[model samples]
Target: MRHQKHIIAVFGGREADQKLLEEAEHFGQLAAEAGWIIICGGKGGIMEAVCRGVDAKGGISVGLLPEAKDIEANEYVGIPLATGLGYARNEVLALACHAACAFGGKYGTLSEIAHALNNQKPVAAVESWKIQGVHECNHAWEAFEWIQTQLK
Candidate 1:
């Protein structure tokens, strides 16, 4: 039985620098082209970048907003959900994704990575944390390749 949610959680820093933001967007475009739905904690920075790419490709994206109790409409996001779970939403993101792709991030991204690993979901990373279990990639293509293989 092939158990696939076909959802890939993208975790990254809200304060990500320009390079990381660009990489995340490119990754999103590639992933969307592969027909995978992108999910991320809703806000700005990396999340918004990914949304832009997804929107460009007419691909679907789900945003889990931590602060909002009601779904806030976003032009880029196909589905905007208000979790009201705050940082706890990371746990939901982990459970909902088949795999994860992480770019440069801070503590929140670290937590999402940890949760995905804990759920036994494979994680492909780019310039993210150097945790032992993370499959680190030099760039988005490498990470996307690894992610595709894992999903398969």
Candidate 2:
């Protein structure tokens, strides 16, 4: 049995940024424990951290990927949906979520955040490189709690 309520897409850096990865994983775990489906880019860094956290907690996760490239999906990803549309497919992934959380990131994360906001999905930023939507704590736990409260 799966509890799929408002899938929360987490967007952040691909690089091995410690802060971003920690925050992403924390947020992903929190969301999963709270019974929300976790959605992500399905790659590395923030995405990998989040997926790992979700899996560790025995929660569900979805990887809305650009395409199934030579590389494989992250270990934590339960469902990998290859759009085959490249980065542009990010819009579809971001829009699919009822809400989105953005941590430290560059261009790709920024794009997902933009799409989520454009689609009216409540977007939250946790110590992001560029702040947008709701600004909250630097920690993912705090950010997730705030987002949950906002949705309620």
What total of clashing residue pairs does each candidate reach? 0, 0
TM-score of 1: 0.93
List TM-score per model, in order: 0.93, 0.89
Which candidate leads in lDDT? 1
Candidate 1 runs further than 4 Å off: 1-5, 70-75
Which parts of model 2 have CA positions greater than 4 angstroms off?
1-4, 68-71
Residue-pair clashes, model 2: 0
lDDT of every predicted structure (CA atoms): 0.87, 0.80
How does model 2 score by TM-score? 0.89
How close to the true structure is residue 3 of candidate 2, measured as C-alpha lDDT?
A: 50
lDDT of 2 by residue, 1-152 (tens): 98548788888777857767777887777888998898888887888899998987888898877875625678788788776778987798787888888877788877888888778888788777455565556788878987897677
